[model samples]
Target chain A: MSKVRFGVIVFPGSNCDRDCYYVLKDLLQVKVDYIWHQEEKPKGFDCLILPGGFSYGDYLRCGAIARFSPVMEFVQDFAEQGGLVLGICNGFQILLECGLLPGAMLRNQGLKFVCQFIYVRVDNNQIPFTGAAQPGQVLQLPVKHNEGNYYVEEETLKEMKRRGQIVLRYSTKEGVVTREANPNGALDNIAGICNERKNVFGLMPHPENSSEPILGSQDGLLIFKSMLQYMEDGEFRYGGGEEFRYEEGREDDLDA
Target chain B: MKRVLVYVTPKKGILDPAGQATQRALQSLGYHEVEEVKIGKYIQLTIQDNNFSESSIKEMCSRLLANPVIEDYHYEVSDV
Candidate 1:
């Protein structure tokens, strides 16, 4: 089979460029390249990963300025053409700011920058990234962010659900990962989401951290594996896992 | 002329560890009467037309200014 080419974007303040670089090269055994955020566009690659880090010092707000980067124009164009893309943590925030994703991430409700390995359930395994995994599988992954809260309105949330855009959720206290397990306390306990087309995926958790047992657990490898499978199969398999439960009193919305 | 007041708040499901920590700080400062505190942003904008509608501004809130799901926004428009 031909090798898959992957690219990682490096913004001015991105700290995880190398980590993401090493993982895609060593673990996935794919051709990986680092494109600076200031570049005019993403080079030819089948997949793109936006690693997590504080971009532009998280100034103004998380990912506010990075969205306007020159590189993102190309990245957006790539995604619009059905290429696969993944954004982790701040990258996820940038994707939202760029309107590549549906929702927004706010400051941690606790108002603290949290850094730890949290367990998340793979809720939607039908996408190209998570398609091979079974629903309700819990994967312990590292999430480091001060602003990782996801917000969307009820109607839009419903649309995302109908479209199978939600891909992961927090693991419940009982060790089951489901949409209801919202570990970060996100809306629908969503840990990750994809665009309507499912080729663009964004999540706060760092699967690259858990790709190997020495690093943590191999739980996150499935995400990449699933993507590879999609490249081969051209289709995804779906199973309805836990029912989505939107927390009551989650009526809080933002306008500025 | 018209003006609109916009309020931004964190959605309920997301963790607000910072707000909770500040509330704890306020309690230890001898202000024991405070029950809860939520941090948010507020902005006021003036428009040239009185016909400026809430839906138009709400579009701005959803598209660029705010994330409506985790954050709730409330606005009051006044005609000058």
Candidate 2:
């Protein structure tokens, strides 16, 4: 099969850009390139990665300032055209800030920066991002962040649950969902979610950090493989995803 | 010159961990009577343009100064 081409975005303060590049190019042997935040071109890539880190030094909110980067416009356009987008940690924040994904992140419920290996249950395996895993599989991943507490209104939560938008949830290694297993008090234990269209995914855990066996887990590699598999299937092409408007998404209605 | 004061606060239903932590600290320091402490951002912008409008400032707050999803913002414009 042909290799999957991936583009990893690099905002000014994104420290994980190189890590993502290493995983895709060295580990997976896939064709990958770095797209600086100022550049608008995201041409001819099967997938895009918004790697984790303090974009804009987490100023004015973790992902707020970086969301306005020129490259995001193209990324937004790409996703609407049925391209796959994966956002990790700070990348998730930027996606939320840019309205590529729904909900907002708040400070960790304990008000401390949390850095540790945690297990997350894959709530849905039917979607492209988690398709390589079993429906209730638990994967070990590391999360390092200060603002990883995901918050969404109760009604939106219900709607997302119905659409299978809620894909990952913090859980015990045994795959039990409980408050004690939640590392960051995210509402509904949400560690990750996808847009209703299933093309854009954002997760707080750093899959790039734990993609190799030496990193103590190879489970992270499954996520990348899923993207590769989805691309190879060649199903979701130019016209499969739902219509997406560039204006702030579901969050706008919440202000009312 | 004109000054714009913008206040961005967590929305009514959103949890404010920072504010809650501060409140705990204050209460521990014997300010037990303090019922609540809500944290927010106070921004001061000095406009050199005479045409600076309140509507524009409001838009600024809505667009960048505050995230409408989990926060609310209000601004005041006055002569500096």
Candidate 3:
């Protein structure tokens, strides 16, 4: 198969462009390109990533202005046709602003930016990006953001739950998913979620930061590996596949 | 013209620790009489033509300005 093509977006205030670029190119050994936000179009990339940073200085809310960038027009089109899209931290907020994701990310409940490594449990493994994860598996990833609180309506939340679209959940040391363990107190302890089609995923955690053991953890590497596997297989399953879904209200020991 | 005021607040079950901290700070500064504080956003918008409707403004808020999940919105529109 040809080298997996990855595109990392660079906005004016985006500080993580190089970080994401290095991870995809050096760590994953994939063909990676950094696309400027102002570019009229981004071509020849299999996947698009909106990396973390304070875009437009986080004015008018975290991602409000950045959502209007020219690249998003193409992103919107790309995602509509089953292209893979990942949004981390501020990028997650941009996805919400653009309606690519169903929920919105608000300011941290504490009103201060929180930066640290967290244990996130893989909740849905049927999606193209998360297929490498085994259900109930926990991985440590870095999260640095001021606005990462995820919110969705009750009906939608229930539907997402029933549909197995939730990809990751914040886990306590005991491996219990709860709001108290969430860095930003997101709804249902949700750290990440995919669209109904399972092609697009938005999460607050920075998987690129944890993709290497030298960076403190290699837990996030599986996310990239999973995406690569999806590309190779050319199969994208919705609802993370029915076989991977755990029985309701199940709990297990946490490795964290 | 029609003017609308939209108030956006965090829904219950969602932590508002920032609002709590602000309330504590206000009390420390001798604003002891204050009962509570819930920090939220207030947006005022004006639409062209007197025939503009409240549902239109509500739709705008839902699509462009507000996220209806953890945020509940209430708006009142009046002729200006």
Candidate 4:
């Protein structure tokens, strides 16, 4: 298999860009490059990553201002074209603001910045991002954010569950999905999800931070390794076949 | 100039930790009669164009000033 080329987008305030680049380039021995936020083109990359950080100083909202960055337009197009895109932490917020992913993030339920290693159970291993793990595999990843609570309409949540779009959920070390184990009070204890096509993935955890044993856990490496396996096997499914239709509801009538 | 004051708030039913915290603080401060509290963003923009229509202002609110997924926004436009 050919080397998988990964592009890590670097927003002005993105602090985890180097971490992702290092994991892909040095640790995983893959081809990776940094894409600046001002760049309007994301050409010739097999995978694109939006690292975690307080982009645009978290102005207006966590990712509201950064959503309009020049690079995000390209990222959207890339995702629509069936390119693999992973958004982590602040990156997840940007993906939500850009409409690439469903739902929105709210301030932590406790109204505080949460920074610690939390467990997330793999809800679906069929998707490219989690293909390396078992269906109920548990991973310990570091989640650090002030606004990480995920919310969606009840109907949308139902649809997401039906379609297996809910990729990861906050869970106990024993893989129990319980409200008591929820770190940020996310809806259904969701920690990560993918778009309908499963090509775009967004999660509030910092997988890059825990990708090595020296970081106290190598669980995060599974996600990246899964992507590599998917690429090597040439079984990447392009989501462009079906028309992307979000379930219509009262929420869609907001602009009407 | 036309000044537009945009108010952006989390949609009803959405959990707002900041607003909840504020409400708790108010309750602790002896405001027992307060039913609820909601926190939101107030953005004031001065546009130089006099031809800006209400529809366009509403469009702006929906497109950039607010996230329709979790927020609702309304604006008042008036001559400065």
Please report, in order, the local distance difference test score of every candidate based on alpha carbons.
0.77, 0.87, 0.81, 0.88
lDDT of 2 by residue, B1-80 (tens): 88988899999979998888899999999999988889999999999866787788877887788999999988777887
Give the per-residue lDDT of model 3 (tens digit) for A27-135: 8788889899988677898999999899999875678889989898999999999999988888888888888889877677778788998888888888877888776
lDDT of 2 by residue, A1-256 (tens): 3578999999998998899899889988889999888998757788999999888889899899999889989999998998899999999999999999989999999988999999999877777888778767899999999999999888888778778788889988998888888888999789999999899999999999999999999889989888887888775322123322223243321132
Give the C-alpha miss distance for residue A78 in model 3, angstroms. 0.7
Residue-level lDDT of model 1, residues A160-236, one tens digit each, is 87777877777654555454344455776778999988899999998887888898677788887777777656565
- Per-prediction share of native contacts kept: 0.65, 0.76, 0.47, 0.76
Tell me which of candidates 1 and 4 scores higher on DockQ: 4
lDDT of 4 at A210: 96
TM per prediction: 0.76, 0.92, 0.83, 0.92
- After TM-score superposition, the amount by which residue B12's alpha carbon in candidate 3 deviates from its true location, in angstroms, is 7.5
Give the local distance difference test score of model 2: 0.87
**Model 1 per-residue lDDT at A205:** 90
Model 3 DockQ (Cα-based): 0.42
DockQ of 2: 0.78
TM-score of 2: 0.92
Q: Report the C-alpha displacement of residue B5, candidate 2, in angstroms.
A: 0.6
Ranking by lDDT: 4, 2, 3, 1
| B7-38: candidate 4 lDDT, tens digit per residue | 99999999988888888899999998988999
Instruction: Give Cα distance to truth, residue A61, candidate 2, Å.
Output: 0.8
